[model samples]
Target chain A: MRLRADLVPQDNLSYQDVVLVVDVIRATTTATAFLEAGASSLYLTAGLESARAFRDDDVVLAGEEGGLKPAGFDYGNSPREAKEAPVGGKIVVLSTTNGTRTAHLAARSAKHVLLASLYNAHAAARLAHQLATEEVAILCAGKEGRIGLDDVYTAGVLAEFLQIMGSYELEDGALTALTTRRAYPDPLEPLHLSAAAQALRQVGLEADVPFCAQIAASPAVGVLEGRVGEALIFKRA
Target chain B: MRLRADLVPQDNLSYQDVVLVVDVIRATTTATAFLEAGASSLYLTAGLESARAFRDDDVVLAGEEGGLKPAGFDYGNSPREAKEAPVGGKIVVLSTTNGTRTAHLAARSAKHVLLASLYNAHAAARLAHQLATEEVAILCAGKEGRIGLDDVYTAGVLAEFLQIMGSYELEDGALTALTTRRAYPDPLEPLHLSAAAQALRQVGLEADVPFCAQIAASPAVGVLEGRVGEALIFKRA
Candidate 1:
């Protein structure tokens, strides 16, 4: 399999058979947690208003606006909270600063889109490699179209898992990510140094960093099913 | 002192007191070499046509179109050639694929602009640190607006040198670069693995890689003076 990792997604990213979108400092981790917690489906909205529009008795609203829980939301973008939420068989409507927007972008060209995080990195890599027809791309949900160190390091973890499953040529971004991932033996070292983690800490969400850094904590893989209106829906695979 | 490394120059980079533009594959190296070889000034153009416009008998035209010397140019983007050229006291008009364009962008906001490469990495970093009043940004001249591993590694080298000069807070990109730089003991290892080096090898310019990888080979620091028409002029500082 041919493999590439875009440290940050851009308008010029080419099509791939399998695309893994990673947002380790919350979005992807939270999404994976929701899936692992037995949520039947997760709808990723681009903004708060769209996510709030899905408010219903059967749906749980979960997301963050500025690293804080939005007003009246069921939960903030906290994986720990997501893991503990009793959402089995219920649909989750989510929106965040970066990850959801990146999912929408990844859905534009890839044959398959899978949400990836340190929480489910191994499982996501295995599923993606098994499903890839030829090319596989790991796209980091960068902060506001910039390379987020947290996401890049998470991409490195997924890239490492993918390489272990098979022989694949690595791109520049992939090589950089691998180098970074290898440098920090502890996941929290790099993750805590990231702007994302610092932002979370500034908002009294410091616990989320360690929770998000738990590598392979979940075997669940959140695979993009299809788009329903403005939200891209994901289901456990 | 505040230090930041932009692995790839983007639209969102904030203002900095000093900006060091690095294009390790060839551009900045060649420019530095020309100044070291006693060239009076180097004019950086964004394209081939503008470089050709400076076709005066006294001016030496140098640049690469696609990893190869362009037709009618005095030399390709080769630091080795620049070192040996009889460009003493003569003006050299240069245009390159990525480096010159990045310099133009850097000139837009920086109080001081310096060309950096492994050839003059130490001097460039020192000069930048000395010239900076508040923030210093190392801008990597990435390949076609994408992160080039060679440039990123070069940025790391510069960042390392800057850190040695004093204590400076690092941004995420700067931290990533420092990690990458620390991982490679030999500069040629990462440089050879880069897509930029692969392209150069494909075009039979493999010799340029080692030449560009020579750390601190030259003490010459190319400082941007001002612009002349479509070209940004650099002089030895």
Candidate 2:
């Protein structure tokens, strides 16, 4: 499949088979934890405005920009916050700078769409493999307008797993990550120099580093498929 | 400086003080040859319509879409074609589906840009190092939206040179190449299995793989920095 990791989202995503959107860092990871914790489907919006405007009953409105929660949201894009928040059996109107926008954009093209993270890398790969009608494209939610080491690194990890599976054809994005990962077995060594990487590293998120670095842990698969308004990913499904 | 190999010339270009664009398949390598052969400048446009409309006695309209030369263009995005053309002391208005687009896009962000190819890797690196302003980001012109292996492979060679120079910050893109080159030192192994690699393998350009694999021709620095219309690149200018 064709895995494309573009900084900007194209309105007409060339997804036909199955499309997997990965926001591994904080968004999809947070979404997976929230879903695994018994939260119902999430309604992802591209921005904080649409999310804040939603007034559905029993829906948890959450997200962040520049790492801070929106002015009047009930939650932020933190795994800890998702684990602790009361979101079970309720809808979530979520929004984030990059991840959510990617999900929304990817949904426009694929026959089936999924949100992936390190937390759900294998599951996403497996499901992506099974459900892929033609090709699979993995879209990583990069930071701002530059290359975020975390996303590309995570993309590399997923690519490693996918390459091992040995059935599907890899598109450019996956190849980019796979070749890159092969090129640099240890991606963390260089993270210290990046502005965003340094910021995350400074916050003692070093724990997350190793955690995310692990090949595939949670094996959860989050998706944004079908009609668009109703975002749902059938995990292990 | 963050050195990256982008197969496609969208955004997420590493803002190294110096930017190197590689179209290993042909355009970039040929562009370097053209400039060395004494072409004045290159104007990279997105489509044939714009490239065909150019009217300048001193300018040679060149390039194509889908690998075929546009009906009215003077040249196509092929190094062999460029080598055969008469571009001495003339501006070449260029437009290719990928390379020119990349050049156009990179010019929007990079402070300085250059075109590098297997034909001129060492020369470009030396010039890039000499022009070092802040950092160097290597932009590769991939086939379509995919990251071409040749570009990444070439980027790896340049990344090592930069790394040896010391005191430079390597972006994930550059580091990815540096690490990849180390993993598979053998150039003929299809190190990354990327489509570009496969394409080259199909055409027996695999030998070019080994040639581009070696870092620096001992002392040949492929230094190219220039502009074409609004898009100013290191090599085409």
Candidate 3:
């Protein structure tokens, strides 16, 4: 098996069988937590309007634009909020600056798209390795189309998990990610080092950094079931 | 001052004033070594035809297509070859798979463009820091448009050099690069771990990896002088 980590979404996704979309600073962490918190399904949208359009009595509109919860949204892109919310059997509509759009973009090229974060690194890697035919790509949802330290670090954790299950050939990006993962043994260190973490700090949402770094706290592997319009619908695998 | 590393060429070059183009596996390494070896100038072209077109009695046509020297070229993109060649007071027309094209692209966006490698990492960083108006971007000429561990590692080394000269704000990519640099203290480790190194080894040019990894081997900083036809001209600073 070949494992590659794209620090950002480059033009190298077409050959991947399984792609784990990572936005560990919050997006994937929150979405995975939402599912683990008993949300029936999470709808990932690229824009806020699309996420808002899905809001219904049972659907929770959740996400952040620039580290702030969008106007009138039910919750921010916070794993802690998603975990605490009474979302049992309810659907979640999420739109974030990087993670959601990245997931949608990756979904177009990959056969299987799995949401990954430190929150569910082990489970995501296990599911992706089992589902992969040849290549498993870890796509980091870098902040605003730039490389994010948090996402790359999470990718390293996921790559390490994948390596334990099977023998895999790593690409340059994967080697970089593994090196990053080894550099910071504590997940929160990288999460704290990221631009996303700083953005959240500026917005007084600093707690989310550590919240998103809980390694394997949730066993939920958010798998793409299908799409509802432009929104990708993910359900726990 | 602000420092950032683009692990790959992303769409984020507009804000940069000084851009250090790094392709440590060979292109930048060879170019820097050539300048250090008393070459008058290096003309960087993006294609084999353009490189070959500049061949003359005084101009050395050099570079590789896929890790091997092209037919009828004076030399492959090797630092050792550049270091030992009788390039004194001669012009070398060079083209490679990634680095030359990357330098051309960056020259269009940056105020100052410097060719960087492990060969001149410290000097390039010092020159860039001294020349920057505000932001200094380390642009890794990633392998065929994907992240190369060797270049990213070199970027990290450059970023560290900049830090020693002065205090600067680090962006996520710079942070990642620094982490990568820290993970591989011995430089040659990341150089050998890169796919670029593997390709070179397969082509029986394994010596080039260590040759490229020799830190600060050259004091020459290949600064962009101007353009000659489609080639960007560089001379030692």
On residues A23-137, what C-alpha lDDT tens digit does candidate 2 reach at each position? 6667777787777766777777876777766757887888877666778788877766676678779877778777777776676656787777767788887877777656767
Off by over 4 Å in 2: A1-12, A55-57, A164-166, A183-196, A201-207, A225-236, B1-7, B11-17, B37-65, B68-95, B109-111, B186-237
Tens-digit lDDT string for candidate 3 (A1-237) = 999988897554464589999999889999998999899999999999988888789999999877888999999888889899889999999899788878987898789999999989889999999999999999998987789999998999999999999999999999999989999988888889899889888989999888888898788989999998999999999
- Residue pairs with colliding backbones in model 3 are none
Ranked by TM-score, top first: 1, 3, 2
Task: Tell me the TM-score of each prediction against the true structure.
Answer: 0.97, 0.80, 0.97
Q: What lDDT tens digits, residue by residue, belong to model 2 across residues B1-237?
A: 444544345654445467787776666665665676567666666777776667578878777555556776777565555655788878776676667777766666666777776567777777777787667778877766656666676777777766676567655456656655565566444333556556556655444344444433333223335544554433343
- What are the per-residue Cα lDDT tens digits for candidate 1 across A163-194? 99999998788899998999899999999999
- Please state every model's RMSD to the true fold in angstroms: 1.4, 4.4, 1.5
> Candidate 1 residues B17-55, lDDT tens each?
899999988999999999999999999999999999999
User: Which candidate do you rate higher for lDDT, 1 or 2?
Assistant: 1
The alpha-carbon RMSD over the true interface for every model, in angstroms, is 1.2, 3.2, 0.9
